[model samples]
Target chain A: MTHTQQQNEHLWQLMFEKVAGVISTKDLHYLEAQLREDESMQEAFHAIQISFGHEDLERLKEDEDWIDILSVIKTRPRTTHQHRFGKYTVAAVLAGLLVSSAGLYFLTNRKTTPPLAAVTAGESPQAVVLQLADSKTVLLSDKTTNIRLGDVQLHNAADQLTFSSPDNFSVYGGQHTLIVPVAKSYRVTLSDGTAVWLNADTRLQFPFSFNGSSREITLLSGEAFIEVAPDAGQPFIVHTPNSTVQVLGTAFNINAYNPKQVRLSLVSGSVKMNTHGAAVVVKPGMEAVYTPPEGLYTQSFDEKTVLSWKAGKHFFDKASLSDICLILYRHMGIKAVIDSSLRRHDIHFNGMVDKHKPIQEFMDDVKNMTGVDYYFDAQGILHFR
Target chain B: MKRKVEQHNDKQLLRRLRTGDPNALNDAYRQYRVWLLVVATTYLTDEAEAKTLVEDFFIECWDKNLFKDVRVPLRTFLFKTLTERCKKQGIQINMYP
Candidate 1:
């Protein structure tokens, strides 16, 4: 109200901006001193403090992410919603303008905001962490499934998908195999902040947390696209019995089913592919194959064929009918025994299986194409005699 | 007696709040408000805008008593709750209004 009181308040505003606001001992002292000197100042400070004491603030503070967030808000200007009272509102609103624009410009484009290159090609999705109820955990791959071991609902947005639970402070996925039968689809985030989009007949086992230096998940069977979260402190590694794929920040896919060797495809960023001492860095658009005895992964352009499942199509450039049958067995939930007489035959076929059709439709197509009569006996087994 | 929210943490606070304990509510507010404002400001930049945003957030918390089971930590609950609020307004938080 008085000129002196108004002047002191303005001084506090300037000081608040100067600190970029962590509210250190000095700030607390200064704010207290100003309040003691003038009752009106006490009222003014109380109004400002009111924002800091909001109930929402308490709930959010219990979350670990509010630290940097608090800095931005404390220093930003006030909005018109806060100003309905008058001139004080105008200054607060104007100040809010500058702080918010600065905050937005920084956060929305922090990586690409001129000074720093976005670290990657474009705005990639953020990392997601899935926590289950019982404290047990599992990372998900685009190829693994049946993770019904926890009580949670999963949703995805960009790179970050949060798992919300009614009975948990943390969600659990213990070591479970999520078999996403081929032509079918499923999605989930592991406890360590990785997002997996699994394709048909895929299965993998993941722990709740890396718990060790390296974050690891074992791929058993199927194809999956993974957007690994970036953590410079701890590198993310995917493992099969014979190979290891290590990356810090990148997008890639793995097809390391048993009996078929292992395939790792890099979509973006970089990856180090190793097959027991034979290793190489796989750049974007390259696929690496590693198998036992052969013990080494060769690289090439099977990139398009690799990601075909992501696009909801099967890419079998010239795959053998036996291998194709294996794919069908897992995806269609059937058991097949191909005629040994036909084993040595080329077995190779080239065509796209849409997976969107029923198993009978797929069997029909396979029977028509191979010109072989197939019969399913009472035991749920298919015999080609 | 202020319950510790036996079903989870913070649920007690929300319940205490439903009965109108000014100190408990203010304590809860003090613990969360400014931080909420900051996170909200990232998406809703104007000061008047930020203040109003915080006000609405408090209003919502008061109305819903969302701290039910406290399934996630308070901060996660707050960030998620505010993020949803910002999203509903079709405006990003900690950014321009």
Candidate 2:
């Protein structure tokens, strides 16, 4: 460790000592300033912060030392957070840290890794921050945040949750899950009012705030139905799994979740969809298809088959059975598997598959059309051959 | 919007277990083994033993008609009881009340 490294460790020990008490704005500011002096220090501070994201600061709040010493620090909710990051703590301070889901910690008392020197934005990046219910914090972008795999919301940068309708929220700074629970979906209405309907199993990210003259968000592989809120001031942009859609307030759908292709369907307004640096500006009712050779290229498409899910309808215009399954899996978490024997069907399907019909009914119809048998287990394991 | 699916409303199954049905014991445990492990995870330090102990707790619950009170929610009661039992068994609950 370097001199700065020793200083960083000393800084952390000081914070830990004060953590047993209420840290004042002055205390926090002092620490933050010490960190802001060097990128290494900021990374060091965050590493420590992430480590104790799961601490029961509530117990710390009740500690005589904490209660007796400070202002803006004596509030504890009924429950803050359980296990966040790798550590689990349960307590509250003026700005107490919180964690959502928890599991056993296998590396307790382990030596800490060297602090990250610098955290950089992606060349093609997707970023977000959560505004948690409590004023505490978390990094949603860390792959480690996928601690418990299930439908769970993680709030990163708030003290209280005040979202009823779509509000401007951040996907935490790290790997986060944008979970849309069953029976209800979330319409992420950005500050620009570009409504992105996040399906049940989807996760995406936008920076805490837009950058430069363009509004941008990156899709790190998940399905989202985006209606770019038009702003003459700043052109809205969505960077998907493969393609990038630039629009000036247009109603469009883009599915880049698949590796080989990006399907952009325009409902109204105009959009410039591109793949592999190529571009196609599309009018209303048209779709741009982009496929890069390394799975990155762009083309134009007649978008007669978009807006199916938005209108609560499944619009299939001569789509293949495999294509149909991909659509269903994206919008709904249903897995459809056809037996190898059924691969020869090479069948094209049309008409709408609405949410009303039990998935079994649709699978039955599919089986009849392709002469393939489909069975779903209680665990939702669907097998079709 | 929707609650966790861990909530199960299989009343007769619970009643059967409460009434000392041995076959029901094996069946229900098999069905809820995963969920119990998840619950025990919050309490037990040893991930491996947490799973095993949670399974054993279910076996005990099944044999004892732990779900005898239908009016009271079975899961809530079971979890509260599990917390008490685990604590007694030296399962350290870092900060649970």
Q: Write the per-residue lDDT of candidate 2 for residues A69-91, one digit (tens) a residue.
A: 11211232211231112122211
Candidate 1: CAPRI quality band: incorrect
Q: Which regions of candidate 2 are displaced past 4 Å?
A: A1-185, A294-304, A317-321, A340-344, A377-380, B1-97
TM-score versus the correct structure, for each prediction: 0.42, 0.44
Minimal lDDT window, size 10, model 2 chain A: A114-123
* Number of residue pairs clashing in candidate 1, backbone atoms closer than 3 angstroms, sequence gap of 3 or more or interchain: 58
Computed on alpha carbons, the lDDT of every model, listed in order, comes to 0.52, 0.47
On the 0 to 100 scale, the lDDT of residue A90 in model 2 is 16
Q: Tens-digit lDDT track for model 1 on A1-385?
A: 3334334424334333222233446646765665576564444344234323445334433433222332333443432233222222111111112122111121121111321122122222222123223322223322111222234444333322344445333434344444344335566587766887776555555654555687887676566788898888888887766777898888998876563577788888889987776897887888788777777655676666777777666766566666766666544445677766664465556677666665566567666776656677888777654
Model 2: which docking level applies? incorrect
DockQ of 2: 0.01
